[model samples]
Every structure is written in structure tokens, then in C-alpha cells.
Target: MSAAFSFNRIVAIGLWVVGGGTALFLIAPILAIIPLSFNAEPFFTYPMPGLSLRWYNEFFSSEVWKLALRNSIIVAVFATLLSTVLGTLAAIGLSQSDCPARATLTAILISPMIVPVVVAAVGIYYAFAAVGLLNSLTGLVLAHTVLGAPFVVVTVTAALSGFDQNLMRAAASLGAGPVEAVLRVMLPLIAPGVASGALFAFVTSFDEVVVALFIAGSEERTLPRQMWSGVRETLSPTIAAVAALLIVFSTLFLATIQWLQGRAELQKTHREE
Candidate 1:
């Protein structure tokens, strides 16, 4: 028993170390850029330069950046709404054991996530071009909705796992309609999952560049697309400010997900007890 305990302790320590190291590795670049965003020096090089908010000021004041930010918010909002509704419905439908072609339908729905973004972008470009949707806001929103739906489906499906379907039936027997049952019972139970899924969908659409690059016109350029152009055409500290902003947004989203998941777990445990 002592030997087994020691082995488990060692394994736990080793896993913690590995996890910490991997996280640092992934975050090092963003961390490095964030500090440089405040650097007073014109160049992106290292070493002490005075700190200032010049770049951040520039980002806020610039018309280009403002337009890009607006575009990003608009696209992300619509995409999140559409993806959440569609994906939640699909997840609920697919969760039923009696659903026809369930596996095939799931695969098709999630294919956007599995397939290469470049390939998907190319396909969307050609398809939208044919329908006069190319270079349009609607096209961008539709494209992002496709990319975001898979995350929602996966999140909601996980929330539904081990769920007691009898509760839904009980609601039905109480004279509750399908929509009422879903809204009153299922949604409350899975609210965390739905919120997490919607946030993920928003983040995915907001940060996406490749598909936007292929489809968006100059007038419809998103934050990521604008950043891509800035990086390629002009090396500036404003880009660093944008990167820092994105990092902050990503961190907040991650923290929100962790909190929601923890809350969900507590709720589940309380119910079980």
C-alpha cells in the first residue's frame, strides 16, 4: 500500500510538471508580444525600451482598426447566435438513440472542424461566388457559422451525456410542450454548456483569418484579416497592441469556460447527492 501511494504521488508530480511546461511553451510567444506592445521603442527587438501606451492609443484612434473591430464583432455575434441554435438542436436530436443515420449526420455536421480550413475556405469561396455572396457580410457570417457549429455541437453533446431523458418525459406528462420542456428543464440543466459553446463559437469566428481572407472584401475586413495585412505590408507596434488585446480576450474566455464547467460540476454533484 505504501509503495502504491508513493508511485501515485510521483506520477501526479510528473504530470503537473509536464502540464506546466507545456502551458508555458504555448503561452511564451503571447507573453513576449504583450510586453513589447507597451515598448516605447519603434522596433520589435528586445532589451529595455521605455514603456508607453502609444501603440494601444494608435489602435483605438485609427479608422482602419476601428472598422475591423466593428466587422469582427458583427460577424462573431451573428455566427455565435446561428451556430448555437442550430448546433444545440442538432445535438439534442442526435442524442436520441432512435435518431436515423445519427452517426453519418454527426460526421457531416462536424466535417467543417475536421476538414482543413484552407480547403473549406476555397470551397466556400467558389460556392458563394456562384451565388453572389462572395465579398459580402452574409457570406462571412455563413462561413463562420459553419466553422463554429461543431464546437457548439460537441460542447452541448457532452453536457447531455448521462443526462436523464426521463425528466424530459416527465415534463411532457405534466402537459408541457416540447419547446416548454426544453426551455424549462433541459436548458437550465445545460445552461453552462450552451454558454460555453456560444463563447467558443464567438471566439472561433472572431479569430478566424483564412476564410475571411478568401471571402471578405476590403470593406468587410475583420480584425484578424486587418492584422494579417498589417503584418505583411507594414511592421508596426499597433499589431502588437492588437495581439495583446486578443490574448486578453482569449484568457477571459478560457477563465469563463473553466468557471462555467466548475459550476456545472457542482450542480451535478448536488443533484446526485
Candidate 2:
């Protein structure tokens, strides 16, 4: 008994150390960005010269920044809509399938997430330029949707894992068609997950700089693209202000998803009873 207990303790301690180190590595860059954003210096240096909102004010007042924010929002909204529709349908289809190839199909669907953004963007940029989609919102939306679909697929897959397909059958037996069953029965249940996935898709597109950098120059500049340009041209706190705003927005969206998911689980329980 003493030997087993000692072994378990060693395992637990190892896990804790690994998990803490992994978390710090992931979070260090973002935590660093926050402090630098508030630095009073014109450079991306830190000496804690006292925090100021001056950079944020400049970001807000700048016309270029405003336009980039507007563009980013537009692209993100469109990309989210596209990914939500396509990904939800794909998820439902995959879940309903009994084929042996389902795993392969899933891999194909999510390949975008694994593929290098630069390579994908390069190919897309050339294609769009050839097809007159370069420097256009339409091109940007399509590229972002391709990139964002994987997130929607992954989230909805987890949600569907907890779903009871029988409820769908019952609705259909009560004279509902597939579309009606999905909308009235499945959707109300999985809508929370879909909503969360949409939020993630929005974030993916909003922060995407690589594809935007290659495909859409100033004509379709996003907030990230603008920030990239600022970094390359000169250091400015205005970028920090932008970063802070994004951090706040992401935090709020995550909180909303958690609340919605909790309510969804409660509703599912009540229905089961």
C-alpha cells in the first residue's frame, strides 16, 4: 500500500509540474503583450514608466485604425456565418454516418487547421488575383471561412458527443421532416454549441494576419494587419490599446459561451427528466 501511494504521488507531482510549465510557456507572450501595451515609452520596451491610456486614445482617434477595425469586424462576421453554416451541417452529417471512413472524412474537413497559413495564403492569393478576387472583401471572407471552419467543426463535434440522436428520431416520427427536426429539436439543444463555435470562428478571422497580409493589402486591411504594419513601421502604444480592447472582447465572449453552455446542459437535463 505504501509503495502504490508513493508511486501515485510521484505521478501527480510530475503532472503538476508539466502542466504548470506548459501553461506558463503558452501564456507568457500574451502576458508580455499586455504590459508592453501600457508602457509609456515609444518603443516596445519595459521599465514600468507608469501606465497611460494615451496609446489607446491615439488608436481610437486614428482614422486608419478605425477603418481597419471596421474591416476586421465585417470579415469576421461574414466568415463566422459561413463557417457556422458549413461546419454545423458537416458535423451533423458526420455524426449521422455509420461509415468506416468517418475518421478520414473528419481529418479532411479539418486539414485547414494543420496546413501552414503561409502556404495556403500564397496559393489563395494567386488564385484570387487571377480570378479578380484579390484586394476584395469576398476573397478575404472565403479565405477566413476556410481557416475558421475547423474551430467550428471541433466545438460542434464535442457538443454533439453529448447529444441523443433518438430525440431527433422522435421529432421526425411526430411528422417532422429533417429540416424541421433539426431546427425545432436538434438546434435548440445544440444552438449553444453552435453559438460558441461561431464566436471562435469570429475570433479566428478577426485575429488572422497571415492570410490577410498576403491576399488583401490596404483594401481589405484587418485590425491585425494594421497592427502588423504599425509594428513594422514604428513602435506605438496605440497597438497596445487595440490589444487591450481585443483581450477584453475575447474575455467577454468566453464568459458568454460558458453561461450559455451551462444553461444548455440544464435544459437538456430537464428534457431528459
Candidate 3:
């Protein structure tokens, strides 16, 4: 029995080592771009050259980059608003419903993440062209909101799962109306989850390129569009700079989400105890 247990332990350790190594191998190339972004050389190659912040300064000072950043910010903010509102309402309504098809409804609501971006982009482009919204910011926002709504739904639904139906009923029994109760009680409780979801929605819209490529014209070009153009036009280190910035931004956004989730979990535990 001792021999068998020792063999099992060795196998488990070996498996863990293999998994960890594979993960690092996969991530190393992506992580390699961080240092490349800081290279003093104009090219993508690395050597004994010192690091510099010129690329970052260039990104901020360039008119092309500035315009793209502005457009990206606008789209992200608008998309986040729409996704949070729609996703929250959908979560609440689906949670309340006694229908047997609630699971199916939930699946349908979050299907955008599963569908290929290229396919979705093609469908939306034709659809938008028919409505005269192709190449417009509003059209891109609408497309991004639909794509991001699934993330919001998933996050908000996780929060809603822990919601107290009894509290809502009790509030209704008192002098509180539906809207009032929601504003005073439900919103406060779910605020953290909503915040996290909104952050994700913003990120989703900001980073999205495929749909933007289809729908947004020159006037509405976002940062990723500009990056894509840069890659096609030149193989400069400037593209690496932009990629590094995006990585840092994404890391910060995800950290915020984890923080909110931690806070929510602590609150839940306190209430339970």
C-alpha cells in the first residue's frame, strides 16, 4: 500500500510539472513582446540596447494613435452602459421567471461568445448595411454591445444567484414599490458584480477588432483598427508598444474584477455567518 501511494504521488507531481511547463511555453512568446516594446532600436530585434519610453511618447503624441484611442474610449463607454443595463435586466427577469425554459433563454442570451467573430461580423455587416448603419460609430456600438452583453450576463447572473428573493418579496409587502426596492436594495447589493461586469464589457468592446473591421469606417476607426493597419503597412516596433499597453491595461482590468469578486465573497460570508 505504501509503495502504491508513493507511485501515485510521483505521477501527480510529474503531471503538475508537465502542465506548468506547457502553460509557460504557451505564454512565453506573448510575454516576450513586453520587453520588445521597450527596445531602443526602431526594429523588433533585441540585444544589449537600453530601454526607452520613446515609443510610449510616440503613441501619445501621434495624431493617428490619439484619434484611435478617442474612438476606442467612446465605444467602450457606450457599449458598457448598454450591456450592463440589458444584462442586469435579463438576469433579474430570468431569475424571477418560473418558466422551465430559463436555461435555454440564458443560453440564447449568452450565445455571442460561442459564435465565431467572423461569422457574426459578416451577419452584422450585411444587416447594418441594409439599415444604413454600416461604417457608423452607432452601428459599431450596437454590434459591440451585443457581443459584450454575454459577458455582462454571465457575471451579473453569478451575483444574482446569491440574491435573496425573500428580501424582494418583503420589500414589496412593505411600502416599497418594485423600482424603489430595486434602486434601494437590489442595486446596492449587486453593485460590485455590476461594476465588474461593466469593466469586462468595456474591455470586450475596446479590444474587439473583427466586428469593428467590418462595421467601422475611417471615421470610426478604433485603436485595434489602427494597430492592424500599422501591421499591414510596416513592421515597426510601434505596434509592439501598443500591444504592451493593451496587456498592461487588460491585467489591471482583470485585477479589478478579482478585487470586486473577493469583496462580494467576503460580504456573502459575513451575511451567512
Top candidate on lDDT is: 1
lDDT of 3: 0.90
Q: Please list the residue runs of candidate 1 whose C-alpha ends up more than 4 Å from where it truly belongs after superposition.
A: 1-18
TM-score of each predicted structure versus truth:
0.94, 0.85, 0.91
Q: Rank the candidates by TM-score, best first.
A: 1, 3, 2
Model 2, which residues run further than 4 Å from truth?
1-25, 98-101, 257-273
lDDT (Cα, tens digit) per residue for candidate 1, span 221-252: 99999999999999999999999999999999
What are the per-residue Cα lDDT tens digits for candidate 2 across 1-273? 999999999999999999999999997887777887777777777677787777877888889999999999999999999999999999988888575689998999899889899998998888888989888888999999999898889878877877899998898889999999998988878888888889889989998999999889676799999999988997677887788788888889889988877877886677679
RMSD of each: 2.0, 3.2, 2.3
Give the Å shift of residue 240 in candidate 2. 2.1
What lDDT would each prediction earn against the true structure? 0.94, 0.87, 0.90
lDDT of 2 at 41: 70
Residue pairs in candidate 2 whose N, alpha carbon or C atoms collide under 3 angstroms: none
TM-score of 2: 0.85
- The residue-by-residue lDDT of candidate 3 on 4-33, one tens digit each, is 999999999999999999999998998999
